[model samples]
Target: MAPVSNNVVGIDDDQRFALMKFRRSVRDVLKPEHNDHFLLRWLRARQWNPEAAEKMLRDSMKWREKWGVDTTLATWTPPSVLEQHFPSGSTGFDKEGSPLIIVPFVGLDVWGLLHSVTRTDIIRLVLVHLENYLTLARKQAQTHGPTALKVTVLFDLEGFSMRQYAWKPAAEMVFTMLQIYEANYPEILKICYIVNAPKVFSLAFNVIKKFMHEYTISKIRIYGSDSKKWQAQVLTMVDKDQLPQHYGGSMVDENGDPRCSSIVKPGGKVPKKYYARNMQNEAKKEYTKVTVKTGDKHCVDLLCADGDSVLRWEFGVEGHDIKFSIKRRDQDGNETVVHEPRKVSEGPPDVGVLSVSGPATYSVIFDNKNSFLRSKKVYYDVIISVPERDLNMSDEPEDLEAASAVAAS
Candidate 1:
């Protein structure tokens, strides 16, 4: 069998030449850290088509400049958002030497916090961690090679609820993170291990799964909701010494109890002391509402002139399934599927961005026509928002204060 290059089966002389040309085109933009391993990720993201990869790389460069990603890496950190809204910790390394983040999901009040603060700030908080994550990952890669240059997320889901799992706003955040992380920060998640998840979690997870690529979905390993069942598996992936004692490891505090004893003591909310002080003054995000009653259909139309143009959308359903489809309609009224029809659910963010090929009316349809007695309603916002179109930073980062807060805490 022939080997695959960027998921493409055949890579001939022309393709190789094209790849070299593409990399050369972005020579000035390449930082010292932008090595073959780094360039290869963008290539794989575009399936090794040099033209597509080149376009992606150009757009990403423009985006990085606009967002001041390097600047953010040097200066930004949202302490209140981290400590109050979403509490998380950077623990020890994984078996591959990648940095590990132990997220005690059972403790977070996902819906409550989304209601309290702007979802935008929540995302910024994640960016703070992502910035730090890369620094740690680079150090790990120095020891274990580039393959170790990713973060492993072990979701401690002991007390996760369907309420938190299926909540629409939280779902929206998940989708937003999925889009941003996948496009801008490709090939970064080494693996995500989820443990002690209840059966009901699957329903919400099925919705969450829609936002993930098959390659990404494959990296996730669920250890069941049973502690005994996952303890062995967790122990195998991480050294017992580094493992949090809550998961049955040797990490202990001064009292000789689990290191995460308070944080992981079943379900609890982040305390008032840590809640964002200026949350009320923060600008909130906006969303468009879409309603679909029984036996009715709705479709959004966009005119795509060229393949260079990107199309993006984000939406959440109100606890019901809506049939979603993206198709291209031609002059003769012939419709061809761009994205196939799937039953869109009430959780996770249903979002996608792709470069369109043919010029025509691209329609995003939501069909509730099949349901006899039930009606579905969804809140959504669609943006044919292309990459790097507007090169501007809209908000100021709380830099020094955030750093001080983290250090002091």
Candidate 2:
């Protein structure tokens, strides 16, 4: 057979860069006699046909359009984004000098979901074969100082419900890996998470607060969205004292000797304001409840609140009429505030609604006086209110025919 063309295939730009570097590193080790066999074997292992390798290379040019695998160079930046969020200092570094290794703890289902949604081959690349490559990179970085060390993690949220997907494992994995990295590689400035979310950002703050006990690193920072509000909230909680005190040590009344009174004297009232503020803050913790009707006319009721403050109240209707409103009440149980109602024409059925049962009522409460002031309780009630029309479960032939026609063509 004739000599194979210099063209290569079955690789993305990042892969190609890695391949080129690999080729260069082994150039001296691979004598001319070994070059063709080694290269051919590597290509074959990747499922490239020896006879069709040239065709694949030529085809790769069109693959950019047909497969949407553009080889455009990615803009390179310092991995500071990861570092800023997950700073891995010099504690976990191996004696031989390698970047800390991070393994994600996401469920397989989440992995599959992300794979299907993203369809990025590099995702498969990392999931399947990046560990070995990362090890090599870490070794190289160690020998060359921080320039060679790199850290990265992957996240998938499939196992979690849509609501739970907001955070949990992703945030936990990123925070844990950062902690490990910081301990092992103090000189290494950053680490990276492959995906991002608001909850993950919040989790990072939680981790920072926890870390504060042992390390005095700067507060964790997040970019994008109303991050400042979240950061401020988290920091304020972290900085506040969360300890309870016994006030007005057992006092003696004028008539008694060593009287242990139930009430403390004047000094006891000093902490009352703080206690009330804490209680009010706890009462303000938010909760949600939902109600739905399924039939010719679909309607949904949502109730959400924090303490006496109603965060959300809305009734959504299907088809011609959809409306929602929210109201808040004061301590006296009177409606002190009302919000403008929003109305919109009905469109498609909400999958979120279909997945859940009807007439749901959700509530959340916080214990304002808890030493550790997190939301204390969350409650949910779902009531299904099926319409009378739905009880007569017979498909009309005309309706079925129309639906089939719409589905078919």
Candidate 3:
């Protein structure tokens, strides 16, 4: 293995050059705090391919802008349910000085959570915590060196149940979070220790692990309910002074409870009063209505003239089931299925958001061709949103020129 100019091991001359090239191409978007170590994470994720890394970084920046990661997240207040029941905390750092994040996995009441708040709010809550932990790691890196640039997580799977995840919404939320983490925050995990996993956990892990990136999968170490085995492993990486006594460590909360209740809120079932379903009708957005005749398909083409746009949709069929899918056609007339066709019912609108890099047309299709008896009426709200960019801060021209220069070289 060769070393890069930044003293990051395992990078040869080619990778170093690619890193430099990738850095220059995205210079306009780089924050004052971003360094070669940050760029290398993206490069390594894309197998040291500069162009691929650039695309990934640019797309992530667009997502951040749209989600207000830099602007609103700092001051955003989470719903009370989340503030009281969200189960995670950082009581210490790993041996290498990386921030240690502990998640009481069994405390995640996905069903109660989704009912209490919009799915968007749940995702935003996750983002707020992730950003906060990453910020901690960045700060620790100043004293602990690059080794502290990542986070070490301990997921206590005691009482973990697969029942909630059996529900489609819960499962979808898991995948959505995994996808978001892998794409936007690559290589941020120093390690992940999942302890107290029941034997049945293998079944769930087998399915969800498929959604994880190789880098992420490689860092996970799973253990059975044997406390001694897992405790010993944890103690090796985390000092007892920085960990809660409940996990074979010496630290305790101010009240002297071993579980560190002050830091890691033991999230329990959310009260029914907070259910968003009860208030759905109070404020509703209008939807466009259209009918797809029997043996015919209705398609709505949403043009994303600029790449890095987000396409969001909510729809439901009236009185029957309808097959819905999304496809993208690019400048060369190449078509690709963005979402596989799925049968959606009239119960709740099938809602989803897709991040697309496109100078392309996205077709939202409601197919009723298989239904020979009756036409299907679809109620849908679809929008293509571009991140609001500050014109004074815009760097499109310079980014384009840098990309051209890199390509030419």
Better of 2 and 3 by lDDT: 3
- The residue-by-residue lDDT of candidate 2 on 1-409, one tens digit each, is 2222335555666655545554564455343332332344343333434334334333333432332223221221222222122211211223233342322222223322222222122222222223343445445553444334443221212122233222223223333434433332222223332222333334334423442322223322333334344334323322212100111112233444231121111111111222211222223323243322322222233343222211212122333433333333344445522324444334422111111121233321111232232222212322222222212221122334468789999
Residue 114's lDDT in candidate 2: 27
What are the per-residue Cα lDDT tens digits for candidate 3 across 1-409?
1222355777799988998899999999998678899999999899999999999999999878867889987898888987887888889899889999999988889888888876667778889999988888888877778888899999999998766764446756776777788889999999999999986577567656656789999999999989999999999999999899999999999999899988987898888877765645444567899989999999999998865555667788998899999999999999999878888888866666566667899999999999999999999888776533311222222334468889999
**How much lDDT does candidate 2 score?**
0.30
> Which candidate wins on lDDT?
3
lDDT of each: 0.67, 0.30, 0.82
- Those runs of model 2 whose alpha carbons end farther than 4 Å from true positions after fitting are 1-130, 150-189, 193-221, 225-409
- TM-score, cand. 3: 0.67
Candidate 1 segments exceeding 4 Å error:
1-21, 77-82, 165-167, 259-409
Give candidate 1's TM-score: 0.60
Measured against the true structure, the TM-scores of the candidates, in listed sequence, are: 0.60, 0.22, 0.67
Which candidate do you rate higher for TM-score, 1 or 3? 3
- For residues 55-152, could you state the per-residue lDDT of candidate 1 as single tens digits? 88888777566556777545755445444547567557778888878887777777556655656566676677777887777767775776667788
Could you arrange the candidates by TM-score from highest to lowest?
3, 1, 2
